[model samples]
Target: MDMRNEATHIARQDGARAASAQQGSAEFLTFRLGAEEYGIDILRVQEIRSYEEPTRIANAPSFIKGVVNLRGVIVPVVDLRVKLGCEKVEYNGFTVVIVLNVRGRVVGAVVDSVSDVLELSGEHIKPAPEMNTSVDTSFITGIGSVGERMLILMDIEALMSSADMGLMDSAQVLQ
Candidate 1:
């Protein structure tokens, strides 16, 4: 099946699975970056689209892949793998843009492939490991442990609004 059709299938199938999340459990959209699996709150996800080359923005950061016009709204696309300092990657059919609604703004994040939504309770989440002062891991809220799999939970809002990201100005950051 084509990527777009596959995405639609996922949305429909996963929507039902997501609705079954336990009352107090948190639902996360799991995705892969390199060899690691990461997750972000499902509420922040707007939609997922097949990868398409976006228009380049001059003087933009390398990690900022470019921008794509979604319907009438132009959304900035970010390569999460690149931004997170993962090894160089080759974009293929499995590559997809995860459109996110972050802090009232729409942005696109590129991920290798989306796994599936997972619901985890508080007990399943472990506190983020402390790192040295130079290492900034504030965006990581916690680690979700499921059976033998580990998922890194991220606060995408914080990551997109961070001063260094430059996607948001001081005014937007305040909101």
Candidate 2:
């Protein structure tokens, strides 16, 4: 190859390497629920708003906190702590609602507090272990470790799309 063509080819190769490095890592929005830490894909998050008392729906499940009006959009909110069977559910000043867009549907998840965005490389994430048969680990995608902190990476879309949530039926999700 000519000298000029060789230099251009080398630069393109470097650019490709940089892009691949970025693609190898994923960003997660970490949050607290009781004493445990959990994370969801940052791309799925729409916004984070302070905890607000939503208008309760009659006869709805306890975990379904209620619905909130977000700029005229009615968004159903779910308490992650309650759904995950946390020992204690408390709403304090630090509590916040994480708005998410799952499969074109808008939903809100209530968490203890909003932590920082964590960038975890593929190597840092480990597969979740198999526990008791009664426990459902389908929603748990993996466990990420960064220094002393460990984050339970959740497949929020799968959890929200489940039959129990009643937000959207599985058939509808497929469509």
Tens digits of per-residue lDDT for model 1, 69-90: 9999999999999899899889
lDDT of 2 by residue, 25-136 (tens): 8899999998999999999999999999999999999999999999999999999999999977678899999999998999999999999999988767775654545555
Where model 2 places Cα greater than 4 Å from the true spot, the runs are 1-23
Clashing pairs in 2: none
Q: How far in Å is the alpha carbon of 94 misplaced in model 1?
A: 0.6
Q: Rate the local accuracy (lDDT) of all candidates.
A: 0.85, 0.85
What residue pairs clash in candidate 1, if any at all? Answer: none
Give the lowest summed-lDDT range of ten residues in model 2: 11-20
